[model samples]
Target: MEKKVIGRRERITLPEWGLKMVTAKVDTGAYTSSIHCTYTEEREVDGVMTLFYRVLSPDNKKYKDKIIATSNYTQKKVKNSFGQAEVRYKVSTKVIMFEEEFDAEFTLTDRSKMRNAILIGRKMIQGKFLVDVAEVNLSLKSKK
Candidate 1:
């Protein structure tokens, strides 16, 4: 089946994560997309650090309905906007937008204070889109 294309900036829904109508910034400069999370806890389950946390939006609303995840490994020394490095947990999941699905990495961090909850980076959108900076929500608005 052919995949539906998306733009640089679009509103997406994470049905499995119970996140609806969240805006994401499509950044080609970044390799992985990061999501805003809080109350992160790492517990050993079957010799693996099972991650559980709550994702928060800029409005301080918690997506408490969907607050569970597990990953194979955790990456240390990840660089932040200030060029300083910090450890972060990477979780793999399927992101659905515009009727298209793709495997994407979601790095957990507290971005509740930031403007956006998700950053749809290049890795998730590689070969799947053509970003037009002047445009926003092309997929959502087109349906209307």
Candidate 2:
């Protein structure tokens, strides 16, 4: 398959979460992708263990404090910016970029301090995309 060229920064859509055009940083240095989560908790619902979480910030007009639950999740030990290993919940979800949908894995973390809510790491784009630092929002511009 031909690899698509993605900009250093681009707007992405998380259709399953009802999130659209969320700005994401394409970081080839990082090994795995991550999505910002203000809150996260695990609860036992009926006979199954369910994970409940909220995406983005409550200040955002569109997706504010909406509780999203999923049972398909696992814990992964990922290194933080400080190079410290931290255990975070890893969830498989669909991410739309360059008008193409792909199954991507994202680690849930608090990125309220970061500029972008989503971080597109190497794993998500491995063998699938090439990052070009010279451009930004290439996907959005293609739609125009």
Candidate 3:
């Protein structure tokens, strides 16, 4: 089991959502991975409680006007960078990192103000990846 060396920033994809080649900032301080959602709402689908959300803003080049919903989700309160506690929706989806794919949980929230839409937290890369502060897109070059 060799660990993959990832940089501070890496290219990630969500095949289930048809979102690819997106940039994500790697952060060791956070515990749960989060993705930028342009819109989110709590709704009922066929009597099942579900969350309706959309990723990648319409302004983004890769934006394909996608809307995703999940009954398999939960709500959690997390402290943001400014120490403000906010409630966010957590959902599960398949994530592609460094050529490897796996099911990952992501907290959905409005990240329109952030430079990068995706933030890869500590839990997402804990044992599988090693991050180099001075590097970016190391995995991109390898197509991994």
Among the numbered candidates, top TM-score falls to 2
How many residue pairs clash in each candidate at the backbone level?
0, 0, 2
Best by lDDT: 2
Q: List the residue pairs that clash in candidate 3.
A: 98-144, 99-144
> Per-residue CA lDDT of candidate 2, range 1-144, in tens?
888888999999999999988899999889999988989999999989999999888899788868889999999999987799999999988999988899999999999888888999999999988889999998978778
Per-residue alpha-carbon lDDT of model 3 for 7-124, expressed as tens digits? 9999988898888878999988989999988888888878999888898777876565788878999998999877999999999889888789988889988888898889999988
**TM-score for all predictions?**
0.83, 0.96, 0.94
How large is the C-alpha RMSD of every model relative to the true structure?
2.6, 1.0, 1.4
User: What does the lDDT read for residue 23 in candidate 1?
Assistant: 88
Candidate 1 Cα misplacement greater than 4 A, ranges: 1-5, 58-62, 71-73
lDDT of each: 0.74, 0.91, 0.87
Ranking by lDDT: 2, 3, 1
Tens digit per residue, CA lDDT, model 1, 1-144: 444556667988776676667889887787778988766888888887688777765345465555676655466456765678888888777677876666777788777666777888777877777678878898897688
TM-score of 1: 0.83
- Candidate 1 lDDT score relative to the true structure: 0.74
